[model samples]
Target: MNNRLRTTLALLSLAALAGCRGDREDAPPREFFPDLDTQLKWTPQGRSEMFEDGRTMRQPPAGAVPFGRRAGVSDAAWASPWASERDRFLRDDPAYFDGTSGRDAAGNPVFIEKLPASVSVDKALLLRGQERFNIYCSVCHGYLGDGKGTVGVQYSPVAADLNSPAFLVADAPQTKDGYIFNIIRHGKPKPDGSGGFTMPPYGHAMSEADSWAIVAYVRALQAARSAATPTTGGSR
Candidate 1:
């Protein structure tokens, strides 16, 4: 072909390529994938004409439970931390999650006397418990569990002395591992049944494993106190 014809054809091709470049225009552009631009999904806090409530978000079904990570993920080496977290969310074990093994004849929850088998009672767990206790419990229970913390002194009904015999003796109801674990997570309810609590629950802020760790630490403190106290000799 002639050089002038070739130059004209090249110019036309360049112009066509420039037109394909996306740019602001007064007219609406054609969309090859309309779904990508306008998805068939409801936006958060948006109104929906299809539903009777006209709200985009719907309430979960009655008795519905939340699902967490799959059990298979627990087998992975890197997912060990998440494995424990998954168990916490699932809460299948009553003793570990609720701190109660069963109910007594009167229907009162029977708390377990020892920490669950899943929990590892070690120096690391105690250290973690100490750190968490200092941050949360020490404010009321005192660093030594003596109910003499700065905030405890000012509290209306002063915090309980955790080192007291009621909480130290092995057979004491309050000394049960599950009892302490439950108290740490669910707090103590007022006797009046006025929907009030003597102490506020910490389950929202703390994890189940951490609650168990605190129970272990509280036991350690009670044991230390018992050992230091000079026993009275009966005969000699």
Candidate 2:
């Protein structure tokens, strides 16, 4: 063969050898661009030398407000849903979000006597409340709100009987809708001011709407119980 033909054949042989790279091996494959293959990233709970605390995750800066919607966003037709969701996240309404109209003279929260205007009492809302109650509160409060749940019987003080006179009476503080809502979300702290709760807070697992819905369902249960036996009171 000519020198050119020999050179071409040699080049073809080298190309064929290069194609035999599919064999699996224990060692990591060679990376032509190491920077792209091995990127610099901080995983969750990973250590970092850059920070003084040597933590990959950093706390939010002091005075840093939680981000919600953009500044220019308005309650226009197209942006109404977005604005509503942002407002819910912001929790700017005291009566609706915090379940308190204002604080009393002694700095104690003054819960609203009735449900806030934002919450509409309807069949759909009651159904939602029933579902949420069964999932979260029923374990301790019981499906009937009688504090006779399987887990509730095991508790030291036992869960409150939601259908009792204390909660259903018109003049009783416990009858306040906002009070119930707050209890459902924040839970009751020990009377001694010790950093402990009688009822664990469900705020983390549910949204404000769902919490309010539970309150509504509880009221419905009380009403049904009252109607079923006009003269008979609910037992604790």
What are the per-residue Cα lDDT tens digits for candidate 1 across 9-95? 999988986897777778777675587777678898999998999999999796433355454353656666766666767877888
Question: How many collisions per candidate?
Answer: 0, 0
lDDT per residue as tens, model 2, 33-80: 587667789997999999999999999786443446456565468666
Indicate the worst ten consecutive residues by lDDT in candidate 2: 63-72
Residue pairs of candidate 1 with colliding backbone atoms: none
Worst 10-residue lDDT window, candidate 1: 63-72
The collision pairs in model 2 are none
**Model 2 root mean square deviation, Cα atoms:** 16.4
